[model samples]
Target chain A: MKLTFPHLGNAYIAVKALLDELGVDYIIPPFNNKKALEIGIKNSPEFACLPLKINIGNIIQAYREGADTVLITGGCGPCRFGYYCEMEREILQDAGYDIGFITIDAPRGISLKEYFSQLLKITNGINIYKIAKAVKNTTEIAILVDQLEKLTFKMRSIEACRGDTDSVYRDFQQEIRLINGAQSIKKYISQTSQKLTNIRCNTGIKPLKVGIVGEIYTTIDSYTSFNLDARLGNMGVEVDRSVTVSNWVVEHMLKKVFHLPRDLKYAEAAKPYLGAMIGGHAQETIGNSIMYSQKGYDGIVQIYPLTCMPEIVAQSILPAVENDYGIPVLTLIIDEMTGEAGYLTRLEAFVDLLNKRREMAASDR
Target chain B: MRTGGQPIEALRKGMEYLAGQLGNIEIRGAGTTGSGRQLASVIIGADIVKNEITAHAVAAQNLVPEVKTILEIGGQDSKIIILKNGVVYDFAMNTVCAAGTGSFLDRQASRLNIPIEEFGSYALRSDSPVRIAGRCAVFAESDMIHKQQMGHRVDDIVRGLCQALVRNYLNNLAKGKLIAEPILFQGGVAANVGITAAFEEALGKKVIIPEYYDVMGAYGAALIAKRKMEKSIDTNFKGFDACLRDYSARSRECSGCSNVCEVIELFSNDELLASWGDRCGKWSSRLEGRPLVAR
Candidate 1:
């Protein structure tokens, strides 16, 4: 049976590993792109969020490819996310796509007995212990792969700033993939670390640094943001990011749900700045921006999808934060047709200005 | 629940402290994703922009070696993803109604003079669920009132509301797809016990709620960033302190065409950085860094 879950931060990695272990046949839709958006927009309600449309588009593509079952996540919250499964089912039915629809509602504080029983229904009595082992292996692999990839990318910028980044990255990806096959997380980490240390690059005189902020999806997904990270790196500048899937799940999902102290104090500290909960992660985004600015970053960039409500609220209030902190903040609104050249030019200019400012500061010092 | 002057300032200070700890990790390049990516890219001077699907999928693949299904629910929407091996195969989303969402419950709670915090606990105590139309928020409300008038207990009514929402959700979003076990339920809504119970009852299955439900989107984005960051030789990050500058936007009606598009111009300390909104690039072309102007 093909099982699937809606796309989220790091869910694909976790689920993919488990499925592989279970030996279940499944298919993942292509990354969100114009085609996904096109199908989604054509099928979805006009006022739906971009993510929803993309997801619908993904299902359409999957069904067209002969996939039968669609797996869904279950939720209950003040946000509109909890009800997506029902709506999507209707849309697909109306569209005449016949397929199996299942939803796995994660238990909040309930016992695992019920959940395990449910699993048996789908797994047909597959070894739970085997499943557990697969999950463990997948998690370890995922973390290791993620960390290595991040380090390699970081090293690329550092190398590229001084030149020869293209060659370095080419070799790095190959080496890291080999290391990813390691049997343990420690082995993977050490192998990857050794690989990174061997790479050499000329470090440029300190370049200006910038912090990125905004809605979670928009800030981190390159397809949505038009590969802005690569563009920035190509411009010979350094960047710092504060969001991650593991941290979000571990800190917010686990901690907030369980009512535990958050590892990142800023989340707790920024709670009050957000005032009434506007829903989504707008509060955290704004809080991070404020935090980044105060810490003396060169600049900050805020990105959001067109017409996102919470982000609009954050945008409306960011001026006050910017003024209070005295940092340059640039906000970008993206849609399907957002031009690449236009985006790049603006970034190039921003970096130039920042670079000049840094030089002036150095001279003054 | 903190509010007003002191809280905001205190939060800012706390953020600063965190920023200080992050140190000077020069960003080579940055990318933006999710619903609000546009504004995020512009604000952070992103060199690349991507959609949440690609970003999330990439992140998930990086995190999990082999995956099967992904369940994602967030503040404004919900979705189901099916993955076979390592590729995304199928997915669905719900965006129109708020009937099964947390905000709907919150609204219902205030309307019924019940504290939202106690909603789930109350639902658990329900002996028999009252029938409430969960097809739409307005219908559910009227139906709930009618049920109350008919002498239905509050707990039963609440439980019924939860079930109705679950039915509506399944009927609408997951209509024609096959679902499998080992499902990961994520996003902010996963926190609700009543809804969780309702889903379990509907599916007759157990769902795994990931450790980070509320901030999964951000975390996913961050994970992607981490990958991108690691591969790069330099970073485009402008440093933490750079965020504390005056950024402003102003909109004006473009009279160049019948569209009369409201052109928005972004500024940082009196300098125009970017402009958008004109359909034909009328206003956008005139902006300082825009290529149309340079051409």
Candidate 2:
């Protein structure tokens, strides 16, 4: 059976490695584009969030490429994401595509028998030993890709020549499309990171540090966030993203299964503001905001789709965080209707504000 | 100075008028702000191009050094900027909606066959104002019509419209922020006394309108230009004579990729000055040698 999955930042790279190792046939849909967004808006419910709409577009795009079954992740939360896979299956079925769905939630969320059955469907008669090896390789690939991206983020801020870091990163993305297995992908990532490290940087310059914290889907997916991390990095601001695909996999998916140690620092930071996990990274948003402020970030940017309940809650509470920490926080609510001009204006204005604040403080000193 | 359906023509006339008013003046530096800043900078050779939020905040700070909040409503956009210690602490702009701005007010005034300038006086004449929906422009228009049909007084309807716009602006842009005083209201819409009164009534505080409210963005651009000129070796100002030159803008969809970015090209006389709006810099970067507009 041919399989297809929605894009989630660099998670696709790991998924590709896993499916390849499993010896399963799969198709990666075109990168998030205007057509995907258009199809998503046309097919999705009027009130649904942007990520779900985009996922619809991705699945439909893949269906056109001869994929009959769709692969997606599931969750149990107050956020609407927990219902996405079920809703999408019905939506697509009503639209008359007759697409099959394979949802992979946390094993704890589903019965062991059901989880293994879903896994076997994708594994295609692979032995348990092979499956375990594939999972290990896939996890390593995810971590390596995220590490490479973090290096790119840092290099972009300090590179002596503008676009130097971007050029290398872009070339790596283009080259990765042809490489197949996890080992090759891991090797390519190391080479790219080395190139990023070799780039000449003006180390003396203390760039303004900005932390990006928000909904997991929007924050991780560059398309949804309008390439926010890259945009800030290009503007010479040091960017620290609160979430990454690998981080999510480790913290949410693997930590419980493997009984790994949890990093409660962000949670402890968030305790004063949000004690409980309401759903969909709301606690993480507050926790990361407080963490960034304590780390002396110049500013924090919160990005989320319009009508996202969890982020809406987080947005309201951010002002309190800003006041107590004396750090400026910019909340950008985006959707299909978000204008590029207005978004750019807000980002530029935020940067200018941070610069002026720094200058004033320096003068006062 | 309004674009009035023809930005190039309006810019030409505006610059020529300014030149006539200040004849024989040597321009040391120049900058452009507002939505059409890129186009304006290309036409007049601006040394710096800034966004409206920064422009508005700077101008407000220049006028009232202790100002804490700035309420700006231009033709198609509105913004709320909160300042602390002479620095922009926070700000929000109207997102994907233009429900309550000067253009909407202008359209409503014309629909009522009232002079736009006199629309506010009618608001002041009414004591009992009707409530109108202000969530969306279309809804507000239909609601206004329903009020008019119900025999509401024109003065009261006008006052209701002002209050509706103010409510929409506050609900949309000023959410969860402390709008501390002294608040400065500046923009084309600040000329509307009705909006000013509504703002005061809603916030329970007096709103101060700057003397040059209509041109505050330009004023801030000038202030920025002055500061830039102090440290710069030379100015990019092409002088008032550049305003006399023919300028035109054209847009074409690039089919190089699936993105289909609509690249805009600005021209001076018949020469291709610069092109932008491409997601991939292939089209815009072609004119890298020229003084490209930096948004």
Candidate 3:
């Protein structure tokens, strides 16, 4: 069976590693671009969120490229994300593309038998030892990719040369798509990490720190956020986000199956604002905002798609947090309708505000 | 509305007026802020360039030190900036909708054959105003026309339009953020007393219009330029004579990739001054380190 999955930042690297280890034939659809968005918009239900539409586009593009089966994670949250797989299947079937779907949902919601059957479909009759080894390699690749990205985020703000880090990152991204197998990807990541460390940086300048907190998919996908991390970094600000591909895999997938204790730092910090998960990372959004504020971040930026229920709740409550903590919160609601000019204006203004606040605080002290 | 060519004319006229009033004063610093900031900077050789939100907030704060909220509605866009402790805390600009901007008001006033400046006075004359939909510009126009055709007084319809715009601004931009006291209202739309009164009625707080309300963004840009010049003694003001030079702009779709970025090239009498709008930066980066004006 030929496998295909939606792009989620660098998560595709780990997935590629996994599929390669399993000796499965898979087609990686073109990176999320204007064509994908147009095709998705044409085929998707009008009111569906941006991520859902993008996923549909990715699947169809892959299908045209000879992908016969789709592998995607499932959620049982209060958000509409829980129903994405079923919706995509229905839409694809109606469009006459007969494709198989393998959804790996959290084990709590489904029987162990059903879960293993889905897993077995992916395993494709491989031995258990080989599957275990593949899983181990995939996890390492995921962590390495996330680590490299974090390093790039930090270095981009401090690099002495303006485009050094970005050029290296662009090269790394281009190279990874062609690299095969877990070992080669891991080796390439280390080489890219070494290249990043070699760039000259200014250590004395204390760059403004900003935290990006919002819906998981939007925060993870650079195409969705219009390359927010790189844009902020280029503005000479250090930007970090609470959601990464590895973080999502660990928090949502691995922890559930292994019965690992959930991380409560974000939950505890979020408690005063949101006591429970309202689904789709709403609690995490509030929690991360509070956490960043406490950690003395210069500002917090919250991004979510239009008509997002949980983030809308988070956006309303952020002002109170801003008032109490004396930190500025910029909430950006994006969709296909979001103009680049307007978005950049808001971002530039927010950065300016943070810089002015810091200068005032320094003067007062 | 100022076209691509009109800004040069407008800037020249504005500078000529200033030079006439100030005599032979030295131009210390120059700056540009707004949607046309990039083009304006290139034309005038501005030393600093900034976005309108920062410009508006800076201007309002300079005018009123304790200003907490700034409501600025320009020709095509509107924005609300919230400030606290003399710094900008948050701001929101209207997106993808030009429902209640000054241009919309201008169009409606001309349709009614009333001078745009006197349109607000007609609203003040009416005690009973009709209800108009403020959700979309097209709907609002049709609603106004329908009310006009039904023999409703022009004054009442004008007042309704003002209230509708105020309502739309509050709903879309304000969105439950605290519109604090000591609020300052500026921008081109601030000249309309009807919209200002509508804002006061809806906000339940007096909105103070700065002395130079219409030119506040430019004022802020000037303040920023002055502050910026403190560190560097050199000025890039290019003199008011740059305004007299012939200027033209053209755009072409780049074939360099699937992005098809429309690269804009601005020319000053045949010497290419600058080019921008390409995502890959191949066009813009080409002119770096070159003297801006060949003459």
Candidate 4:
């Protein structure tokens, strides 16, 4: 049976590997795009969150391609994301799309013993060992790819200064695709790091660096910020994104279980601003921005949906952080109407101001 | 201002600065919305903290005055509001979808090796509209590639994609909802000519994209707050410099019941100014000085 799955960062990569191991045919939906949003927007309630729209688009895309079943994750929490499967199912059914949706909820709400049984429903007696191996490989591949991308991005700033970013980035991307086949995460990480180190960068003067912190999806999804990082990079500024799908997963799951401080307890900081579970990671984002600014990032940019409740709470409190930290903060609320020109103009101006500050600082030194 | 500690005093001073910017103009009443609505109300002393839909509708009505249908799409979501005689009659929102939104377009453009700014312009140049199945993004991409192999012009393909988007929007969000003309498309997406053209073609009429579409929501919220200020005895605007304070928030998990709701408490100094997050009003009411009433 041909299977389909929605985009949720590395989830697709992991699922794809699992399907491959099970010897099942599956098609992962393409990265999120306008057509998907259009289809999703058309097929969804007008007030749902951004991720939902993309997922709807993803499922619809899969169905149209003759994928009979779509796999999705289920959650139980104050966050509205937990209810996505039910909501998406209803929307697709209303739009007259026929497909099977299989959801895997966290086994916490149910007996852990039943977890494997639930999996068996879809796997249909597939080898447990193979499934485990596939999952491991997929996770490793995703982590490796992500690590390489981050390193490439880090190298790009210096490469650009050296006037070889374009060529180096192309090579870096190819190397990442190859390293995805690495047998272990350790090997992948090491090779990726070495590749980045090999690239010669002209470290003449330090450029003004900015950190971006916000909702998980919006922060990583280029579509959400109109590819703000590339724009910043083009303007000769290094942009550091504070949120990642892996980081989020680790913080929400592993860190909590281990009581590790690896994840900033942003929920604690955002408690006052958010005051309740409006269901999004806005609090953690604001807290991250504060942390980043404290660490001396020249500027901070917070991007979120126009009416996103969590981000709104963060925005209200960000002004205070910006003031205390003496860091310039720009809050851009994205909705459908954010124009390329308008967005680019703001980026250009922000970068120009940052560049000026860096020059002034250098002169003062 | 002196009643609170350093942070509260700093916030108060900032609020005063904001108040000064308004000069002698009196803010009579105010309204708030979004996740931060309640907190914003508490901070600004707003008279109303309504939902986003209501706040947006109110602002649109005031701005356009004759607006019939309102289309608002943001970074992560999209919404359509139908108004009759300046009052919201019906509304729909697509908060789940990212395909038709600006960010989705941004992603596609970057992937296509095209600057997002030039994406609409490319669509405008298309002569023949390519029939892209804009039902879902993944399908559409493969379909577009197939169309490309079929030798369809890029412009036509782009135009077709735009049309498909408009079709998807109408079919999903606007389904069963009356889409009457004088339809004012306000939001980030209205800025795209290709999408706008697709909308016009789909609706077979002119779609009015308002000025300041990008900031309309914030603008609308601000306008509602401004209106409310007029109706109030005193304006609650915390002022501009309020941003210069060391404001922070804390959380405490309530043990009221099985819910064990995590209640967030806002403090200016050490004094609790506000608290929220109780599912059954266990903490929110208490912090706001209202007695908790059992449901």
Candidate 5:
């Protein structure tokens, strides 16, 4: 079967590795653009959210590129994401695309028997050892991508040469993209880290730190937010992202199976600002912002789609958090009409505010 | 199709205009707002560059100390700012739709062969306003055309359009907000008396228009610059002389990675003055000393 899936940041790297190791023929949809959004909006139900429409457009585009099987992950929250697979299937059927779908539910969320049965469909002909190796490689790939991204954030702020951090980071991504198997990832990380240390950064000036928190879809997708993290890094501000695709995989796939102590620290931190999960990462947004502030992050940037219920709720509560914690917060709501020019202005303004705050605090001390 | 020129040239002219108004006096500090704030900041070497929301709120607070709410409708967007004790407490901007903004009114007015300046006067004369769908632009346009085809008076149709814009603005923005008065109606759309009347009729309270309603964003930015100068050593303003120099901006797509970030470079007098636009600091990081042509 020719397989395909929607692009959601670096999640595609691990997924591509998995598909490659599975020896499956697959199609990766073209990057999102006006054409994709146009196709998506025309085909999707009027009231559906943006992500849903975009994914459908991706699937249709993939179909045109000869992909017949659509692979998607089951959701873990009350967000419309939990119902996306079924809704998309029905819509595709109505549109006359006879595509096969493979929806992978988190193994940790389901019984072992159910998990094994679902896994059986993909592993039908492969040997048990080969399947085990593929799983290991796939998880490692996720961990590696997360590591590279986080390192880029830290290195971008400190690197002395103009493009040193960026060139190294870009090269690392290219290097990893060509590699397969679990063993190569550890070596890749070490080699990249060594190269990073060789470059010098200014030691006299302290880097301003900012934390990113918001709805999962927007927060996870760099393209959606116009590569905001990297932009902050360009301004010499080190950004800490609370959510990553790898974090989600471990939380949803491995936590229960390993019987690991649940890291509910964020939920605890959010308890004071937001008592419970009101749906769609709102709790995490509050929790992570608090956590970042307590860790001495100078500011918080909350990015989400326009009219996103959870983020709007989170946006309302962020000012209180900022006031109480002595950190600045900027909430940026995006839509189809979110002009990059306006977005950049807000970001630069926020960064300027943070710098002024730092100067004032230092002078006070 | 390419009738509109680059923002850089317009920004230089705006800086020159601001300088002319101030009359050779050193701008104590400089701040920029609106969508082109970045280009303006780069061109003028501004000290503060803020969002239109913060800039508008500040301008309103300075002009009317008792303004509790601000309703801003510009060429392409609209928003409601709820102020508490002279601080920006809350705000909501229009999303996914541009129906209630000045551009729609401009389009409809031009379609009717009515000058945009006199469009509001026509609405003021209307007695029988029709109901036009303002939920979305496409529906609003078709509905307005339908009304006109039925031989409705041009003034009534114009009034109907104004009412529709106000309805869409309030429903989309001010729902459930503690939108108190002395409310200030500001932005480019504030020039339209029809919308001002519509707002007054709907809210059942007087909607005060600021003196420089169309330019409140700039006014607010100047206030921010004033506040900034009170605490800073000197202004970053590049001075009026910078406007005379020939400057150019070009964008190059970086094939560095999968993102393919496009980097922008600005040149003045054939020397590189500024470069940005890439998310990764690959190009911008190479920036050394600030370009000195402004001096």
Candidate 6:
């Protein structure tokens, strides 16, 4: 069965690794672009959220390119995103596309047995142990990819040589897409780290630090936020991106199996502002913003989709958080009509404010 | 709204006009907001280009110190900014729907053969306002036409349109929020007496219209520019002369990678001012070493 799934940042890269390693035939849809959005919009409901439409577009495009089986991550949460998979399935079925679907998500009411059964459907009679190995590899890759991204965030700001992180990152991106096998991937990461270490860095100039927290899909997807973290990094700002694909994997996927200690740090931090999860990382956004302020980060930028339900709740609460914390929070609501120029201007201005804030603090000291 | 071969020149003319109007006020550390903020910033050498949300909030704080909420309905978009103690508390702009913005009012006005200036006054003349569906632009239009065909008075129809806009605005952007009093209504649409009346009637509260309502975005931008300059070491205003100067903006598709990102570059006298929109950061870096040549 040919497999296809919508892209959300570098999660697809790990998925690609998993499918390839599992001897599963898969067709990863083309990167999201204007055509994908246009197609998605044409086929979607008038008021459907952006990510859902994009996913539908991706699936339709993939279907046209000869893919039947669809693999989607599911969640039963307060957020609209959790219900997207079922919606997409219904829409696709209405469009006369008979397709097999595999959904992997945290078991809600269903036991691990039902969850594995759904997961194992795509294995196509392959050895379950081998599939498990592939899962481990994918997990490792996801972690590594997240690590590399974090390193880039920290290093890019401090690098004396401009665009050094970008070039290395670009090279690494190309390498990751092409490179097969776990050992080779690890080797490449180590070599890239060594390369990063070798690059000249500013020892004395402390860059302004900012924390990014927002809707998971938009935060993860570069095109959605127009590569916000990288842009901040280029402007010589140390970025602390709270949400990552690996974090999603750990919190959403593996936590059940591992019985991992619940990361209540953000929950505790956001307590004064927000009491509980309003869904779609709203709690995290508040908690992380508080955490960042306490950690002495210069500012926090919250990025989310336009009319995003959960983020809207968070946006309302942010002003109080800002007041209580005495920190600036810039809320950028992403939509298709968002002009890049305005977005960049806002970023530049926010950074300028942060830099001035930092400079003033230093002088006061 | 004037289409031009040179957007930079258009921006220059706009700046020149603003400079002329302001007289001896030293334009220091210019700032831009609204949709085309980046392009305006590039041309004007803006000190800080903030989003319309922050800009409008800042402007409201500057204009009316007691303003708790701001209802700004521009030509294409409407936004609600909630503030507390001169700080942006929470804000939301219209998304995907232009129902409550001036465009809807403008279209309805034109359709009714009434000048937009008189549209609001006509609404005030109506004895009984019809209920027009204000859910979406398309539905509202069809509903208005149906009401008109049913021999509803033009005044009532106009009044209905205003009420529809107010309903749409409240239902969409201002939903679930406590739209506190001392709300300043500013934007292109604030000129409409009909909308103001409808808003007042609907809320049973008075909405204050700022003196320069239509150009409040511009006003907010100026305030931001001034505020930013006050704290900054250098005012990169680029002089008022840049407004009259000739500059050109051009775009070239960079086929360097598979992405084919179209990199746009602004040039003044054939010298590159700024080049961005490159995914690879190849052209934008060329702008790094340049001085503020616009001055």
Please write out the lDDT profile of model 1 over residues B1-295, one tens digit for every residue. 1213343233345436757886766556566655555545566666555555444544555555564656655554556666544545444455446676666777887877778777767789998888789988889999998998999888898889878978877876676556666566666667777777888888887776666666555566666566667766565555555446656767888654323557777787898777775443445544424334211
Task: Select the stronger candidate by TM-score from 4 and 6.
Answer: 6
**Alpha-carbon shift of residue A254 in model 5 (angstroms):** 2.7
How much is B204 displaced in model 4, in angstroms? Answer: 47
All DockQ scores: 0.01, 0.50, 0.42, 0.01, 0.23, 0.14
Local accuracy of candidate 1 as per-residue lDDT tens digits, A1-365: 76655554334554555566667767766545566778888888876666667668878887777678777654554134446677788888898878667654442422345444544555657987975575466556555545654564466556522323433433433343223222443464556566675666665545466887876667666556665554566455556667655555445444544568777545554665676657666777778887887778888888877667878788767766766776656667776555554455346545644554566667779
Cα displacement (angstroms), candidate 6, residue B289, comes to: 3.8
Candidate 4 wrongly placed segments (more than 4 Å): A9-11, A106-118, A127-132, A161-196, A254-262, A265-278, A361-365, B1-295
How do the residues A1-365 of candidate 4 rate in per-residue lDDT, one tens digit apiece?
A: 67888876444544554566566767767656667778887777777777778789889987888888877766665256677778877888888888877766552444433544555667768866765575556556556556655665566566523323434443433343223322543464566578667866767946578888776666776655666665566456677876765565455543444457764465565555455555566767676777777677888888876567777777767767765666766667675555544454345545644554556666779
Candidate lDDT (C-alpha), each: 0.62, 0.87, 0.86, 0.65, 0.80, 0.80
Greater-lDDT candidate between 3 and 5: 3
**Ranking of candidates on TM-score, top first:** 2, 3, 6, 5, 4, 1
| Candidate 6's DockQ | 0.14
List candidate 1 stretches off by more than 4 Å.
Answer: A6-11, A77-79, A104-122, A127-135, A160-197, A252-261, B1-295
RMSD of each: 23.1, 2.5, 3.3, 24.1, 5.6, 5.5
Clashes of each: 186, 0, 0, 51, 0, 1
Q: What is the C-alpha lDDT profile of model 5 across A1-365, one tens digit per residue?
A: 78899878778778877877878778878766556767888899766777787789889999999999888876556466766888889999999999988777741356645654655566557766786687778888788778878888888787665567767766765676566645565577678878877777878778999999998878877777888887788788999898888887777666654557767889999999899888888889999999999998988999987668888898888878877887778788876557787577567757766776677678779
Q: Tens-digit lDDT track for model 6 on A1-365?
A: 89999988878878887888777788878777667788888878867877887898889889889999889887777487777778888988988888766777732534566656766788776777887788788889889888878888889899886787877777776667677666677678778877877777999988889999989888888766788889999899989878888888877777755567767789888887788877889999999998899999888999988779889889888878887888888788887677776467567657755665666666779
Interface RMSD of 1: 17.3
